[model samples]
Target: MLPYHDAALPVADRVTDLLGRMTPAEKAGLLCHAPVAVAPDGGLVDEPRTLLPTAPTTHAVRDLHLRCLTLMAPVAAGPLARWHNEVQALAARSMLGIPVLVSSDPRHSANENPLTSVPSGGCSRWPEPLGFGALGDADLVRDFARVIRAEYTAVGIRMALHPMADLASEPRWCRTAGTFGADPDVVGALAGAYVAGLQGDDLGPDAVASMVKHWPGAGPQAGGEDAHFASGKDQVYPAGRFDLHLSRFRPSLHAGVAAVMPYYGRPVGVDGLAGVGFAFDPKVVAGLLRRDEGYDGLVCTDFGVLTDATLADGTVWPARAWGVEHLDRVDRAALLLDAGVDQFGGEWCPEVVTDLVAAGRVAQGRVDESVRRVLTLLFRLGLFENPYVDEGNAVATVGRADFVAAGEAAQRRSMVLLANDGVLPLAEGIRLYVEGVDRATAERYTTVVDHPEDADVALVRLDAPYEPRQRLPEAFFHQGRLDLPDDRREHLCALAATVPTVVDLFLDRPAVIPELAGHAAALLADFGAADEAVLDVVFGRARPEGRLPFELPRSMAAVEAHPEDLPGGTRDPVFPLGHSVEALDWRPRTSEPQKG
Candidate 1:
């Protein structure tokens, strides 16, 4: 067997042997972390069928010589396993037969938001990461990570594009649901536990490598806008909390995470740092992360940083090169490499790297340096010996009964009771009026009523308010205003006037809810939970044990006035961070309105 192919050789030795044998094109391909799609019938899709910037699978694997890929398509476990094997077979037939390292965004959550996580397709559905933050249980976070690792490895996904160590410091940030709350210490603890569970005590064949993301925290976007768009590119730290943002990443680094993904925002007020995207700023990537922090692992850019991606539907997702948008693709590629980035995510251009080396803009040694890290990860995961997974095993392990039960339990427990006026743990056999809840599930707990006036109590389900952006992908991110529309607020108030109401608001991101808090008899916040899970808590079958991960602003005025860079900055939060009420025993009370 070849030195690189031998399973017994040291990882460094195998990486060195593989590096010496690779051509310039192969080495370039290793740096392209492009997206690929999966067909419905368990086949590899070679077309750009989805809105994500995906290349033809066959061309990306064989011609471009790409080895690193990200999966964005939602598919069942069996089909995903089949598609994975098919891709592995194609890679095995390539020139040097290097194994493909497949990675995926968080897919084990109940979120259907495309910008953050895909829907849980045959995977065990748990509450979003913020839910784990609400619980603040490191052991629970570790157990959740263990389930994620098992399911991912079963389906041949070696790299987890998650465990976002970013803080939810900025309440209006669309990506808050993906982070562990606003507290730096809590986020650090959960992130460390998550990394340890995924990578274990040591990274090996049994482990799924964690890529802790958006280094230095992607929160604190100027005006609470995301950095994904040019209009929202600035990441301001007016409070001088850049160091606090960096603090969240220290535990993940200590846990020995395999990779780091930097944010796309340009630094503002960061001392001695360029006003460029974190991926293109050498001071941030090389000096701050690599030099001062002493992180030696692989660093990958956030998706579509080098080139603009045009979707199949004629929508353009502009390149998020931010402060360096004036540069050409080659120059952009060189800057990222010089900034110490090892891979270009959502970018399918291998030619950029090859051309950079050919034009002498970047050294061959730099290319080898990144290629060595990439190969080391693949070798450490034992992908060379076995990149393929058993479809039967994948079908058996993914969404298994125990795993699903644990996820459901987490969803039920992660709900935060914001306010209770002795109107909760709702008594049995009462006529209930409901909205945004499954009728069948509500029937099991209480008698269903069509109107609030005709019911003893009303259970109303609502989502945290967000003003929608008119654009395609931007609209997918829940952004802008956090207050409920006037009409909806009035409607809820009217409902409460008719009967006592129990409101369950999905708190994916913190909202301005003082008006609603005033009207609703009781209020509970959830990160992500199913109708059944919500009902379980409402009816005392399960407990609402979650505490607020971040503060809820009293008004949109408060949200706008609060400093984005500082956590818990609102002047008078309606419900401050760590706010939650204990469940009272279920008792029947007179159906009378209680002033909130």
Candidate 2:
């Protein structure tokens, strides 16, 4: 057997052996990470996707010699395992027989953000990452990582594109809910613990190599905007403490994270580097991340940064090439290769790289370097020896009883009671009027009432208000003012007047709801909570112990006035960060959100 296929050999030796045997085109394909369709019956998707072209999974495997794919959809454990087995079988027939390395965004969340994770796909649902951040405990983060790793490995997912190490420094930023809070020290500690739990002591068959993402941190945007759109292209550090963004990433290196992803946002004049996206800037990617930081791991570009991203409604978001958009496809490929990027995410443009090599714009040896790194990841994962998983075991291992129970407990712990007017921990058999909750579930605690006027207490669930966008892709990204409209706020206030209302709001965004909060008898906040978990806290079955991960702004004006680089910089937020009330032995920390 070749050194690459020999399980007894060192990972470096295995990668070198396989890379030496591969052609330039194969190497190019190896460096391109593309997307594919996974059908229910373990076959290629017949229908085309709106953004990506329709290519048979076998074509990518056999013709392109592609070995890595980003899984876009989430399915049942049985079907997902079977589909992975089928895809590996397809690759088995190709020349050199390289197994596929499948990766996915965070799929463990109960409320899935399309850009970040999958929705309701049968994976054990935990609260959004903010839940763990709210707890402010690295030990809990380590525990969550253990469960996430087990679920991913069970379904044959060898790589995770998550643990978004970017700090939620800017509360108004649309991506705040996905992050581990705004505190750099807390973020770094949790990031370290998260990596330790996911990868264990070393890379192996049982380990799921975590690709810690958005390196150098994509959080401190110019106006607290998202990097996904052209409107939010500039990632500026106005305070001149650019190194502050990297505090969370320091621990990732210490933990031996297998891979790193550079964000799509352009860093303007950061560390004397050019104003371009990190993937396109050699000074940042090769000089800063590689030489200065000593990160020798694979550096994957953020998805769709190399090519245009399309929405369902024919809106085209130009390639996030940032400073290099003027250059054509081949030139873009040359620049990326020069920047030491190991892979072009969300793209299968191997021909462009092959042309660059053929035209003497790039050297074949440079291509080999990336090919070696890619192969090493596969070999260390032990995919070459056994690529397929037992479908039966895969079905059983995912979302096991213990995993579900632990996730529920975490969700319950993530609930933060913002305010309570002495109406919580209700005694049994009270009249309860509920909205956004199942009536049958309410019967377990109280007598269900049809009207707020007839009830002793009313329970309502509210979403953190966001300005609805009309455009296709922009609509998915929750941006603009965080304030609730006057009419809706009035309705909530009126409801509170009719009866003492306990409002449990889903807080994906830091909503500006001061008026409604004042009117609400008891205002509770959830990062992501199930009906049962919220009820458990309300009825005294479980205590509300979670602290605010990010501050609730007082208004849009306060959010606009706040500096994007500074956490708790806003002028007098509604409820400050780390503000939470307990059911018993409650203590109120009054004042603006501040660092402890």
TM-score of each: 0.98, 0.95
| Candidate 2 lDDT tens digits, 528-574 | 88898888888778777789888888878888777677767678888
lDDT of 1 by residue, 60-81 (tens): 9999999998888788889999
Worst-scoring 10-residue span by lDDT in model 2 = 587-596
Task: Give the TM-score comparing model 1 with the true structure, all chains together.
Answer: 0.98
Candidate 1 regions with alpha-carbon error over 4 angstroms: 584-596
Which residue segments of model 2 deviate by more than 4 Å?
Answer: 46-55, 269-271, 311-313, 585-596
Clashing pairs in 2: none
In angstroms, give how far residue 62 of model 1 lies from its true place. Answer: 0.8
Against the true structure, whose lDDT is highest?
1
Pairs with steric clashes in candidate 1: none
